[model samples]
Target: MVKKDTALGTGTMADRITDDEFERRMYSHDIAPLPKEMEAIFNTMPDFVVRPKSAKEVSNIIHVAQRKKLPVIPRGGASWGLGGCIPVKGGILLDMSTMDNIIEIDGDNLTATVEAGITWKKLCDTLERKGYFLGAYPSSAPSATVAGWINTGGVGIGTYKYGGAGDMIRNMEVVLPNGDIINTGFDYVMPNGSGYNLNWLFVGSEGTLGVVTKVTFKIYPAPEKFESISYSFNNLKQVGAAIHDITRAPINPFHMGFGDAMHYEYLRKVGIKAPKVGSLLTVTFEGAKEIVKYEEKVVDSIIAKHGGKSLGTEVGAHEWSSRSYEFKVRKMGLGAIPGEILVPMNTFSKVLDDTAKLIKKMKLKVPMIGSVADRNSVMVMPYYLTDKRKFVRSLTTMGFNKKFADIAFKHNGRPVGLGLFFACNVEKMFGREGSNLMHEIKSAIDPNDIMNPGKLVRTTTGFGFDAPGFAMNMGLGLLASVRSLLPRDTFGEKK
Candidate 1:
């Protein structure tokens, strides 16, 4: 039982704690609805929610939890549906959104430091006004927090050239599970001679190890010239070849994204006038005008050699400008089951083909989006959009989502982030040795298992690829057939 003392044995910081019903309900889940089939497993809600304004206050709260042997889950904007911030074991939910502050922008060092709760859009807008920008951001930037993305190993708009959030981070201040504060990266004052890269460990640890209080990210000057071009390919193989050739070329693109034929069909239904068939690839370039123009010429030649037809600059520019809006449109009162799989460039074509086969076998129609992270890898996102009010459809969607993740795993692709939903695959994702090392580190830092206990480690068993049986598959097929008869507008629209 939690101590009812308002002082919390740590003085004034205890006032931040609350067990209000309204707040607990609000913090219960994320954008993704809880699967009805697994409702009984995750039925327990958080016992209390705490909002800390400063690192000192956070330290106090964590120390109390450490002593009480209570679980603590750190929360940011809570925009993602991956269950990364869910308080599964009913303890304390650390709401970090209240710590929204941009602390510093060091022009000389080309770095920006901010509190954990600040949104990516706010940071990007602030830096753009000062003639600087983030190296990369997530698609949910408008609502996703800096620390949240850092914990999830985010990738987005500018990833093609600068890599993911991990590559852009220079340093960070983290509150350990035991309430001790430590600074990672090169410290100008009181440097430690450990010679270990501790900063990267927290990048994708999903907040199971500690609470990130502050982050310093490497920023870049705004590009002088920006241009985009689109290409239409007749087949998935051609699309893969085009991406491979462009990535290998000397020209570095600011962003590179593509959609399969089904994705374009969905766009057309939403009145975008997208192509009826074949794949669409969009490439955005930045830098000096002369250099951009020269790169576009070379890119055009490469696409032509790969059997791609130019769709002109108008379509590409429009798509580039509207990339972020897609998230908002998809989530407008609709149920969406989204998953991201990271695969090597060489297996891009095979992954696409295999995913198409699975969708066909399951009799499900969904839109898939792909992005080239760098020369060697790509990220593929396949999402199912359905009416949230339909109970059968929602449950079926969850089952199909698990099957899709299994397909990615079968093809040697791993999840982009391991939230509660993907916890079952931790061994497959990190291998036995890596998973054991993670467990060892987690045990050392949080011996009592107070920090996000059920995530990133195999501490609990719940719904996953093995949960639902043949009955769920039959239900999914029936629901898919019924959904086919409904109008496309039955799903939501951007407005």
Candidate 2:
């Protein structure tokens, strides 16, 4: 149990630092944290949240942290509700927000270069003026830093058309743990048969590998005309089938999302209403005026075949302007834990059915609202009945992750990435055998265990049967069955 009112603002190392120098460097930028937010994480409180104006300044801070042997957590926007931005080891919070600047916009080359801290919404605004756009439109667009989106594996409304954020990265300039700057991939239009494709490694590495200083990504020309269509279904089964058919169409959609009835009802309570509950599908298309109109007809045919009812309303041209701003709507004190799970396109229905059943079985007091991020990814925001109840607040993420992984594996789908720190305690997701392989990789790169020591790397510890938090997570009967499923050797082995 953490002390609720303890003044843990001061750590032993904070006292050792020269007061004059610390004070001088502290307020050179912005640093502010209220009591409620700071108290959530354990054993971590930054001495100062330092916002530097350039890559040189960022590299300098890393050098300073190394000299002091202080654990540093790099942060931007600070909009993440999870402990992603929290300094679990408690040292300096390196704020990269001040490094935000658009370095280049190659309209003819269809690429743009930008600093790490610019928000997605800001990027979109800038690109709209030039008639070019990027694909990573994660819900945190309004305030989330572009680097945060890349680091955390951003997926958004445009996924149906452009694919994941990792797919959009052309190259990047990163500041490593040793304070040396390195560019992962070549800055050319196409691959030049270079030595290796190191840029791909840092995409979802989450600041654990290095602090991204600059990025270059491919962009598309914005369509002059856009259309939004929402359809209602009597049940999720129909919604799933409708999406599958529409996505299989000859023409591609600009953006597409599927929201189950429960999600629509939740949105209704919050003053936004759509077609009646069982399921809702929103599809947007863009392109030449004639082409868009032609594809709209095919979409209508598919909808009719699936028995979808028109919601009697069309999202205006500006409707998707705020699509990425969904995070802001939920940030207003509504307790929600948004978990993203990716499954194979074929097994999507089974996974959803199994997940819904498990959520109901847990007797979770929170509403389980869900939406389809893309054909391969699903987003579920579990909401507690009340913000104060401990069980409801806990979100029971273990079940969703474990079950989803099983389904993904069975359907031949694999998890490419997950949002920040969840990978720290990610034994279950990777499992014992897989984690052993990860250990080997981590040991090779960070031989001294000096680079973000505990971020994504975990020791083998042999073949321990005990799953972290697994025993206490389930009810008595469920826990007994799970324990029984393991071999006795697993309980008494040291491999």
Candidate 3:
């Protein structure tokens, strides 16, 4: 039994917010919906939704929730397909979109401060106008919010050189679980003091520890020259070798990504001349003219050594400029479910081969795409296009996604973001000792369990056999059974 009015309904915070604003917040709840078939696993919805335009308002809302012992689920742009922003326990959905604002651009310090809700693309455009740019941004930059990506463990566009969003953040203002506002970095007057890197603790915490209100990110001067190059490989092994050699070299490409045959087929449908037989690797460089020239020479040498054929700059330029087109194509179907796993550079080929085999065995239609995180690891993202409204197809997609995660785990890979979907796989990725340490930290900071409960760490009480992992496995088993019963070509051929 839960108290309605006292815990969630119009109470003290109602006095500060208008009814229209509250209703508006409730209307725009989530961007992505869980598979219709997995209702039993994740069907929780927030009781109240509140949009806070300032840190003080956020503090007030959180304070009331704390007093009432209610869960506080923070939300940004809601662009992520994962269940990171969903309210599992359903209490107050803190919509941070209203906090969108670019606070400052410290030219002398080469840093910019902006409200967390601001989109990465907006920030990039703002910086570009001033001859500056972000070090890295996710593929969803156009719609994903700064804090959302920071909290979700962002990795995409510029990871090859600049690393993930965590690497770009210099400082932040975070509102702790108890509504206390603290600056992760030094005070404005003394911005370079030595202290525990608290800024990073909240970076990938997924709002379980705190809500990031504002962020200060390191910025760099806009490059004077930019170039894109493409290469073709006869097989996954060749592509893997090329990536490994390029990543291990002294050259630092701005971005490096590869796609399997299925991905290129989709690209071909979109009027791009992607090779049909094997894999396509694209690399982009941005810097001084001399640096770009040197990096291109090095990349070409590595590709040649790996038995890769140069496709020149035309294909690479088109692909780089139209990177977002892939997402558009993904959505063209009923819906696309993406499974991302980060694996070591050496095992990239092995993982790809294993996943391809699974996809083939399951008769799943998914396109494999990946980007080199750095010299040591790569991020593999395979998207399954399915009609979520169709139970059998949706179940098949979900089951395949779980299998992909399992394969990644077996190959020393972990999920890029531990949203509700990947929460159960934490123990497998990080050993028992590491997982227990994380749980301990979560308990210490959010003892009340009012912050994003049921995510990162399970909060729902269950019997010994009803652990989250067991439940997920059971669901996967059910899905597999249903899929096996379905007729061949029931979901139709891969588009």
Candidate 4:
């Protein structure tokens, strides 16, 4: 039973508290009403879902949680595909969507100051009307928030040209667990001091250190003209080579993505089809009209050299749009678990080939798609249909992830925070040292571990990986297998 929040209580978000008081504090956000399949994973149901309308309200909620030593999980749009946003400890679901307000647009500085709750789609819509744009467009754009995007280190369709979401942020305002509001660098917009960059610390911390109240991003001028094209290759090697060659060239495509032949066939089953080939590449570019035309010619030459058959301009754009939102479509049908992994440039071909082979070996049913980054390596999202073969697909998903991590690690590649199937297995994947570092950071900022505990970082078990709840549902025996595989002191000891 949750008790009422008495006193101002640390001056955070909500002035009042308790599960019974939820109806009054929270408004318009859905409860834990999740599908049966997801309930088992979420563990505990949040006692209340609070929809705060302002930063003060957010701070108040944090203060209340801190006073009560209760856990609070911040959620934006509630469109997170992974279990990251699910409140495993069951306390308060701080829905930030209500605070969706675009604070200001500084055209002179080429930046936009926005609240954490503002949706990316809404922001982009407003920017589009003004002939300006935020460079990154994660596939979740229709429902993903700008703050959520930054918090999770989002990689979008335009990442090939613009870089990751972290690269676009200039400064931000974060509220730490101690109820201290700190402005990182965005305060320097008016000029205070020019030493040390602290915004990056909170950007990818994934809401562990603090609750992000507002964000400032470096926006770019919208391209005057844009073109999308798709090409199909009879072989995976050719497709990989084509991606490498095209990206390595002078023309920088705004978006570049790839899908295996099986993936295209799966889309065809649902009345959507790319050019017939073993693998397909979809490239979209934006620039001045003449520049787009010239780039198109150059891209075509590279495709021809790699034995890629052009599917023309019309079909290509449609394909790119469809591919961009493919995950959403998959959700409505079979529902897919994404496997997002980044790799180094030189070994990209091998990674792609290895990923394809893993999917084949697992005999899982889903599309395996990838987006190239500067011809170095690709961020792969392999869709696994969870509805058909639940247990088998789940196990296969885990296996495929292990394959990706093992192979990528061997190739000197690192994971970009999260992945699809094993989204919450960062500690397991990275090992003890990495896990401890993440936990220590969380502890320093949130000593009581009141903010989204067990989501990104976990507490020390004091008894190795076999610690209580360490295995969760994976069982004690399987935990042994997993523990055996992790490198001891994973975060690394000096030298």
Choose the strongest candidate by TM-score: 3
Report how far residue 344 has shifted in candidate 4, in Å: 1.8
Candidate 2 — which pairs collide? Answer: 261-277
TM-score of 3: 0.89
State each model's CA lDDT, in order.
0.76, 0.58, 0.76, 0.66
Question: TM-score for each prediction?
Answer: 0.87, 0.78, 0.89, 0.82
Residues 1-495, candidate 2: write the lDDT tens digits: 112122212333333222234652432221112123223433345555556666766667677666666555677776554445554445556677777898889987888898988887788889989888776577667778888777766566677678766777788888877778888775546444756567767766666677888888889888877788777778767877777787667877777666665554555555653345577667787888898888888888898999987653354232354455343324323344454556655677776676566555544433344445565555444432223233322333333444444445565554434332345334555777776776676556544433443354431111212223333234323432443343321111135
Query: 1 or 2, which is superior by lDDT?
Result: 1
Write one digit per residue (lDDT tens) for candidate 3, span 34-96: 554454544355666677777877787788888888778888887777777776655677878
lDDT of 4 by residue, 153-196 (tens): 77777888888777777778777777777787763253236765
Residue 65 Cα positional deviation in candidate 4, in Å, after optimal superposition? 0.5
Q: Summarize candidate 1's per-residue lDDT along 358-471 as a digit string, tens digits.
A: 666555666788798888778888877755566655655555555555667777777786677556566666787977887898898888878887776753433222322234
Ranking by TM-score: 3, 1, 4, 2
Worst lDDT 10-window in candidate 2: 458-467
Please give the lDDT score for candidate 2.
Answer: 0.58
